[model samples]
Target chain A: MSLDFGLIIEQMPDILSGLWVTLWIWVVASILGAALGFLVAAARRYGPAPLDWLLKLYVEILRGNPFLIQLFLLYFGGPFIGLRLEPIPAGLIGLTIYASAYFSEIFRAGFQAVPRGHVEAAQCVGLSRSQILRRILLPEMTMLVLPQCVNMAIILIKETAILSIITVPEMTMVIGAIGSQQYAFVDAMFLLAIFYWVLVEICDWLGRRAEAKLSKFRFAVT
Target chain B: MSFKLFELMLWAAGYTVVLSAISIVIGLTIGLCVCAAKLARSRALSIPATVFISFFRGVPLLVQLLLIYNLLPAIGISVPSVVAAVIGLSLCTAAYQAENLRGGFNSVPKGLLEAADMVGLSPWQQLKRIRAPIALRLTLPALVNEAILILKASSLISVVGVIELTRMAQNLSASTYRPLLFYSVAGGLYLVICWTVAGGGALAERLTRTSRA
Candidate 1:
């Protein structure tokens, strides 16, 4: 059977509302993940040798697997460890940890991107270590990592779809519910695809804008 | 976890690798065709190729998997779970691989094509003798990166009822009341597979490093 465009139009508002759930999860998860990642990167960069190696192992374990499996571990598996979480929180935690893994690596690369000579020069100016990190390293690393972070954000947004599998009632879940209920699988799936396409396109546009703005600032500084 | 549970996870992990391996090879073939289409001077071919790349790369693979699994039957073409999963992963990876190969092909030096022309090489000869080797070399690292990404993403196939590694872990964990052990073991198995893929990539990179021409 052919698609009923009128039904799709009627369901636009219900479907579009999933957009907020998606954005909320993405923004909250990214902020939380990036914060945790910053700490981990700092530790990896400046902590004791053994701590750094341990941190590296943590990053590798998370990075080497799929976020869906990570979500399962935190959601289905968490209660075994005396943790019982609902879907949203379980998904939020899982997404955060997953994002943090990649973010830690991105941040480490950002840290490395800062030339050693610059940090040494800051130290030579009699600035304290914390002062050097705050005034010199953080700013530089933010610029270096902004584009990569946005890219990760895009990936994470796409990943938020997986949260629906854990019954998060997010976009994909809502779409599936509506589609199956009305026997409009084709229309529903196409609509879902389009919605995600628009979202990803916006993300990519924002990424380009941030890159442009950051590069302009870097040029001015130099 | 018990040995039986561990064995089950390993069995499912085998499914994961086999499925991903099938998708990567199939996707690579599709990607090469799409790359060739987009590279051609004809807008007729390139426009649809560009749209395919944008659509596949733009949508999330989970959604794609669900659509393939569900929509095919809606249209009276009911495929198996494995077929649907493979289609989803293959098309999704094909888009990314096409772009990577396009980049590799674009980076092939113009001077080499000109040199081939000067040597009286035909178009096919130029492609075989100069362009293919250089582009493949340039894109080898990207191919490896895509392979790892696919291996990890193959986990999503579970939603479509393919009892792959992660799904196997879930089933075993639910029955055994040992999420921690099964998941950790599953994670370790995934890491080993990924590490091997990455190690192979590194080895491939090293082997190709000395070949400049």
Candidate 2:
């Protein structure tokens, strides 16, 4: 089959719209997941024994299964429990939950990397818990966690493609729909790959820049 | 869920495990070659390996699967769904595994290699005794982590029509109107399989540590 730029040009508007949906999903899910994940990490670190066990189980089960299965369960299986949702909402929730499990682990590692003596020292100086968190923990973690969190952002961006499976009309879904109609499957597939690759490369660049800036700040502080 | 339906899911779960196992094995083999190429002195070898790792690692596996499934037909080499699935998974994992291997090898101490050289060890002997063993030990955990990632990723092969665990769950749920039941069962099956693999990896790590000591 001949390669066709004309077809992709014709579908540019649809492709752009699809890309927008992908960006929206990726941004919202990443932010929400990171926020929720930070709390989960903190709770697991300092929460009660039973609560820690429950969160551990939650994290393990989510991490173990595929995101596809989790999405299906939430979208298709939710109706059984009288919690039906539109495909996009279900996808957003599913992705947020999936991302939190991973993000929490990253945060947990960041927390662990900080020396316990620092927290103890802050406490001895009559620092409040929030003060210690702000003055001691957050600064120490800023550099360590930024890179992994950015990596997670890239992963979440890639995962937005999977939302197409549940009919979210993202870039992949648009490509699939147009390809079937135009019979330019190969070109469509390549175009889809380029879209994702560009997104990932941008994230990688941004992550590197942020890490550099943070490292400078870290050095300045010390 | 009915016993019959559960049995079908169990069979499908078996397929998932087998598919992931085969792909990981093939991927690891390809990974070694790519890793070697990446570590080679020549630009020609290293450049292509770098591009391969970047493309596979950057693109989502779903896109890769779709591209392979369709591109094969366009190139007049139409493959079955299972073949396409395996090819997609293997190539994708190979890239990640190559990076992991490169990291492991890079971590091998320069002093240790120099010591081997001083002992009159040939290059091949140094590779076999000093480099390979240290890299393997350093990378064992990452390898197991990749294996589990591949196992979870294998679920995406269902998109190409391979009736593995997730796809089987979908079909059963669609037919029986028991999405919750079947989906939960599928998730549980995946959890058990992943945990077992992880446990085995831990055990292997322990054995290797003792042997090394």
Cα lDDT of candidate 1 equals: 0.89
lDDT of 1 by residue, A42-78 (tens): 8988899999999999999998988887888888778
TM-score of 1: 0.92
Give all candidates' CA lDDT scores: 0.89, 0.92
Q: Estimate, for each residue in A1-222, the C-alpha lDDT of model 2 and write its tens digit.
A: 788968877988898999888989899999999998999999999999898899999999999999999999999999999998998899999999999999999999999988888899999999999999898999898778999999999988888889999999889999889988998888988988987888898889989998988776563322
TM-score for each predicted model, relative to the true structure: 0.92, 0.97
DockQ (C-alpha based) per candidate is 0.71, 0.86
- Model 2 alpha-carbon miss at residue B195, Å: 0.5
Model 2's TM-score against the true structure: 0.97
Task: Give the clashing residue pairs of candidate 2, or none.
Answer: none
Best by DockQ: 2
**Every model's TM-score on chain B:** 0.97, 0.97
